[model samples]
Target: MPANNLRRIHSLDGLKLVMVLCIVWWHCMPRVVFGYSLPDLGARCCEVFFLVSGFLEGYRHGLNYKFTFEELWLKAKSKLKRIYPEHAFFLVLSILVGVTSGKEWAVLSDSNVISAICNALLIQAWIPSFAMQFNGLSWFLSSLFFCYLLTPLVAYIALKAKRPVGVWHLLVATMACRVLLEAECAKHPDIYSMVNIHENPLVRLLEYSFAYYLALVYRGRLGADTCSKKVSFLWSVVECVAIGFALYCVVEFNGAWPRWMYTLVFSGVVVIVAGERGILSSLLGCKPMRYLSVYQMQIYISHAVFYSLGWALFPTSSVMAHVSLFVLIVIYCFAVNCLKRIRQNKPKPTVTESFYF
Candidate 1:
């Protein structure tokens, strides 16, 4: 199949879905499921998100001179339009709930309020929570904005730099990055502990960008439209091994592994997930799964709130409550999609738009 005609793999989608679940379980279940207190794997999931974004952005934003100034701005605008809706909706809703509940946890500080204003502008992710106590998902958005701001620069750099001599150079660079980037992290034994989890923002950008470049390699150029089976296979196996090893560390290593190692592992998994041409996910690529994939942003926005509320109402100790809330979230998604369908079938808002929308 032509790459354009080919749907993304259901396995990749399943990977995403499972990653999302791991995120939820890691956040909500505590030590019960994973034998660790907090998985902090949400960071890993965001890396996957970044890899996808980077690949998609790289593919779309190839050879900067090709697009005129107007086209560039329009492209950026379209990206924002897709990303902003759920974020804005949730932030406002979260604020309403916070204000109404008489709790200061969700209340905005003045500086954070400014950041929130910045966030609302879709310029940055903000510090996440107004009070620094909540808004767990903002971390992903934060890193995403960081990557977005640097996309032009990243493109410029990747386009200009020498391509690696071969896969070995890529491997060496990846390892050197792991060692050097984590050097400061390693020295601070106090900080090296599991609780802190070494979430350096710059490091994340580099990590995801590496995966992005691998995707670029798979596409057969530093920055081009075409795909290459040769380079694709190279990135494919490496990503699989790296991510597989990381999963082992997370599960079998008893959380002894450091955050930097996990980042390395995650970068590997993302390659296979993003570059695998939808082979595995293809088997399960029914409409419902595709629909679920479509609502990723919507579900991401709501999942945190639902989990938090579920915890507040049910707590982790209440297994039945947890199950019930999971069901509720499913129902919530179904209703959201149903309503969206209804609106789509409804008449257009403006006659002008109807004629030329």
Candidate 2:
């Protein structure tokens, strides 16, 4: 599809808000509040974020730009420009807060300095021990950096193929590879023990590849328009079934399903939500949802910073504490966003101001 024909997929922004809110809830809430425990969707939420990211990455490739190295490099650089400044800003603030609080577990210790550097460079996910250091949740950015580096190759392979890499082809191949890796890890327990199982970049890359291939197929088959459409009865039935299965995994299994299972459920939900016109879709596409989506990265990054400080400074044993922290973090995110806009909109230097004295 031509670039102009493609419209921004508003539903995706809504999806991102849902996923990010889940993550925030996971982070801010105590595992067990009073007598009840929170459902375990935190990790699954991360996977959802990865899925959306990979979809957009491939969708952009399909809309414009060649699969050449230069174009890919430019894309990578653009991602860096978008994310690194915010990351660095938060990292510095996190370190400062940790130091000022005199908290023993902050990111500023001598032993943790190396891990902090890894986080700073966005390479922490590659090292198991380093992945969760500093702002632990920030590990997503590190893993995503790895995916970004590999995206060009993945996109090129998909685009060059004679046919869309069938969904089955990608699924079977990914599952086979995962099975082999699992078997090997089983035999050599030390390998798995030495690494963080889920947070590792290699493990997360599976999802990245899955989404990229899926997007390639989607862009080719469905084009760039992902707006809602009336679905036939059978299609609606299938969508409901898929969504039901996904919910079952989350609710009944407490999100203990295998990664592949999670991907299937997320893909189904994403497709249905993005393309099917319904009350839910309308709610997702509303103005408030889309507005928050614009500041998602800021919200995500800022939440980690506040979390670090909150953990250090507050007694978060009660629901009220968690709710208070959540509110403060949201306010902080909005404030930072406003400052960013002010900086962007500041008047540029005049040409005459550059004249030599």
* Best candidate, lDDT: 2
lDDT of 1 by residue, 261-327 (tens): 6656665555555544433323324455544565455556567666656556665557766776687
Give Cα-based local distance difference scores for all models: 0.54, 0.68
lDDT, candidate 2, 205-309, per-residue tens:
777777777776777777456444654566556656766777778777774555656776787677666554555655666677766666667667777667656
TM-score per candidate: 0.70, 0.84
TM-score of 1: 0.70
User: Candidate 1: global Cα-lDDT?
Assistant: 0.54
Enumerate clash totals for all models, in the order shown. Answer: 5, 0
Best by TM-score: 2
**Which ranges in model 1 have alpha carbons more than 4 Å from their true place?**
1-10, 34-39, 59-72, 100-102, 107-115, 118-134, 163-179, 185-201, 221-244, 273-288, 311-324, 335-357
Q: For residue 318, give model 1's deviation from the true position in Å.
A: 3.9
Residue 8 of model 1 has an lDDT of 37
